[model samples]
Target: MSFTEPMGRQRADDYRSAMVSSDPLMDVAAGLDAEVAQYFLVSARCGCFMQAARSLNVRPTQLRKHLALLEEQLQRTLFRFQGSALTLSRDGQLFHAQLIAMAHERKLPVIEQPLIRLAVAQSILHDILGRDLVALLRRNASVRLEIISLDSDLSLQAVSADVVVWLASTESPLPGPSFAVSEPERLAPLEYLPHIAKRYSRVTARPVSLDDLADFLLVQWQHERPVESFRPWHDIVDQRLAGVVQLHSYELMLEMIRCSACIGLLPGYMGRFDRGLIALPGLFDQSMQRQVWMAVKRESAGCEQTRMIVDLIRNTFHERREWFDT
Candidate 1:
């Protein structure tokens, strides 16, 4: 049987992490007693067997036989007919819920591709830009890209990404030389209190330190640029903040910043692109800037596909060097 959804649970060790796990739909269908489950589907939808049989294009006798088979498997009667109306027993409601959930489980979507084995976040494949990048990467090439969904930073570092884009600074990955875009390490501290959202427009003519960022409400990415936990500032964020709201994307954060939701730490390129995000002087120093980097195992980095991807991403972001270097 062909089913579309990736199986098990996101990042689970069981059937999900396994490169291929039979066919997810087939696996799920194999678990249930088909005759009974189908009966439950029709019975739960239509009250009477005769009406359901007509609606489903099956004979009432046939439908009843399916139900009988299911009842035998579960050793429980789903419904009992009283003089005229069909009534669902307590067992029936519970079984009905399971059947619906099973139906939903059957709907997981997974598309098949040939050879490329990629270990990355699901969001990468789903993001607007990410989608474009993927389409570009998969064009008639010598290799196939296997797309895998990674759930956390540990998974990212533990496994391997031919080219990595992350916010955190760490010892260069296996093959050494790495470059960071909009380097997080170089933010120039503002000498004067930075003009944050309009609400903070009058924050203080006096300067506020970066360490004081916690004082203002901050709207941040629910998924931050993956940073290694060892970085001091990674955890420097105010632990006691009353105004941290996590959002789904950077675009939304910029929107919130425009509304003065709070002061935001935005990328130089992204900040300049969004008119709403104007950087004030105090949050970052003149020398402060975040860096984007690309690193890969020596052998993997030599692959033409991976090299092209690295060059495309690096050159694309490299054009924005003035934002950070300036």
Candidate 2:
């Protein structure tokens, strides 16, 4: 219709109808929600509402609502329902492809991630969690990691870590100023330290007794070695009186133990994984083993970053269960 046409009711109605159908900005004005798109994709991947909800750590009802709202906005049914089964419709597949393409093309808006403050000793960080932690940081661009290097005697509350990983024994357990603690994940034992000599053919046989261990210097990770704190195997150390050699990190201690005839307290996981190290038959009592504890402040227990880190830690432990039993 030309603008020079006479003003009439039929002409106005036609103009309004054309504007509504042809407007390029209508879809843009409706607002594309990334979260809704994520929900749809997760549900499709999981192939069920319940499983998708569990995967995304959200309520199934919430996911349903997101899918319903997304369908309403797009004016299309995205899922085909057959009794209890759920499958993506043709339109849903197309939408999924579009959303994934947008993300791959870097067209999606970036979401901010919460900063995570983690406190752990340098030794534990180096020997066990170093690789996993590095991978988490590299994979997650949103997260800002503020790692607090803690000393053995440093108080947990003093550092105020959102999450803290500490080495604790069954006898000592986790200290006061309570945080939600994960199940004790046992470290690989230092029993294998004495066997390093045998593995390297430096010794004819494994050390048979505590007296035999006295022939070698007792090396300990500087961050975890007990000074004033009570060690579980009090008699093992007190009776033998092996001179202690403290190293700054487990890697250095392992290197020292491997190179020389030194007996160090090495993590069981580390010992088991390295073919060059072996566990002495009668040196260590399993009851005296130490464990790795992941603790989080009660206040930040629900924080996304804290939860993600905790899950990653648990998953890492699960993957290395042969070495780091939970």
Candidate 3:
């Protein structure tokens, strides 16, 4: 079969019966299908059916079949044939320009290098930063990311990681050249508290009174840094609240809050995003704002891959600061 052939009346009739029963022009007018357009673009680039087919790793006849489908959809001739040479029609030239413009509209991938090992606090991993982190990691096709979730103390010990994100009190900072961003450590009540006060409820919304905390169970994770260093927690410790309980894992602490087991202490980032958790703004103390730091080992600090990952974490948080508000 020749590469360019007239559409037989019988084939056109069959196509009409099988697919385009009514308003074929409407379907064609919507847009040229991507697969059909891609084939046409390849044909335009190669300037011949056989060469385009070879470049696309398809048979010459198969390429012609695709081009035929495109022509049928457009109801216009895209190519003109003279002996063995091929030339683009006016419609084809316009389409080729459109496809090139569409290609330019796409965003180029950002980071392109090797594997990056990143360790972050487990709570941070599952909370606000999780979705954005995953999306950023995927933008770079060549990156192979190994993400480890740990406590800040353990994360610091994970020297094997290329970069580490940890939450620390201003009193006890992470060791290294650190990009420290302060976010308040917030407390959550077992029930929802609106930001505005109502006469029916004693709980004041935005600046919740510290006295209201006495009514809820106080939950804490054993050996968590912010709790030990923050002064309000020390006050809570002094009182030895009647309902205080300690859990080993942050996940368990969150589940306890969901079940009304206790009022969970949450970092500002997680508290803002969790619909299930209500912020007890009364419990937020300015002196207790914890610093979230992204750090690397002194030796790896200058490595290009490590710097790229660290910069991404810092810049993304700076741009979306509202998500981490107390």
Candidate 4:
């Protein structure tokens, strides 16, 4: 259409006619929406109507309208609500994952600056002070931090992590080449609690000490250590208890603790860097401290920004060490 042309009724009618029946635009739009709703639902982690709505970043009212329209088109309820809780019907789950897989390559977040690949032990991923360092570097747009967690320093699998955070002994005969970043604290044992599922509430807890714990359970990240000699917390086996109950994930260990199923070691103070988990009087001694390292690959040897972040970790922990917590 020419700019000189008036958008009169006749022109509007012509455009509408062109855009419909004989035109393919509506079909294209409809197709695009099919992909959009699914992507929004997956990224949002919303299984039902509300979940899809929340993930789409649209208001519930607007999402409801879209969902109603979608359900009307499909002629089925995607979810069933019972007692204020929303549950996905079969179709909702099928469509949910599809959205995520479709959007994976199309929408990975990107930043323009050179990124600092930071490999950290998953356990210390509690409240990283990295964002401050990241923002500081962003001034010159120098470095963006890529955070990955590995259980062991041996598996520095991150092809890109110029720097890493590791927990080690002040006494280990390990390489002193890596610089220290944060001081470590002794990991003390928490009482084992029951961790049965709600339906299966019949569970029990047994007390075991460092000597009698050889038969107890220990949580270790298999990716970082093998089953027999797993070292989730600085080779807890070296201290050698009687028997250990083994677990793999830190998150899982937390879940186990929540369920009151197993006893595990927890960091005493200034952990979580936010709330801080504190040890009780006889539970674990807080006077003891451990050393954390911010080691760099020989390749990034002289990078000032890398050194700066290590300093940030050290200073953050040192300055806030008083958070002696619960």
Question: Which model scores highest in lDDT?
Answer: 2
Strongest candidate by TM-score: 2
**Model 3 regions lying over 4 Å from their true place:** 1-113, 137-142, 175-211, 225-228, 283-286, 297-308
Instruction: Indicate the residue-level lDDT of 196 in model 4.
Output: 20
The better candidate by TM-score, 1 or 4, is 1
- Model 1, C-alpha of 293: deviation from truth (Å): 2.1
Query: Against the correct fold, how does model 4 do in TM-score?
Result: 0.40
lDDT of 1 by residue, 1-326 (tens): 11222434442343232223353333433577665566667666677777676545466788888887766666777787767878665456545545555667687333333343444343333321364465454443224555555444555556554555433333333222233222222212111123355444554632367666656676655555444331223343435446676776655666677786566555434444445455655444333333333354455655776666555555545454454433
Better of 2 and 3 by lDDT: 2
Find the 10 residues in a row with the least total lDDT in model 4.
Answer: 187-196
Q: Residue 73, candidate 2: how far off, in angstroms? A: 19
Model 2, stretches more than 4 Å misplaced? 1-111, 121-123, 151-157, 176-199, 227-244, 284-287, 324-326
Give a tens-digit lDDT track for model 4, residues 1-326.
Answer: 12223557765565455444523333333354854465335423443454454434345577667666655665655556666666544444333333334457468453354456677656665534555555444443225567777565455442346676655544442332344433333322112111222321222423223333344454433443432212324355456554444566777765554454344555444223323122222322222333455666666656766776666666766665554333
Report, for every candidate in turn, its global Cα lDDT versus the true structure.
0.50, 0.62, 0.59, 0.47
lDDT of 2 by residue, 57-116 (tens): 577788899888778877878788767777766556545545554577666665566788
- Among all windows of ten consecutive residues in candidate 3, which has the lowest summed lDDT? 188-197
Query: What ordering of candidates by TM-score runs from best to worst?
Result: 2, 3, 1, 4
Runs of candidate 1 exceeding 4 Å displacement = 1-152, 170-216, 220-241, 246-255, 284-290
Off by over 4 Å in 4: 1-112, 127-143, 157-160, 172-245, 270-290, 297-308, 323-326
Clashing pairs in 3: 208-282
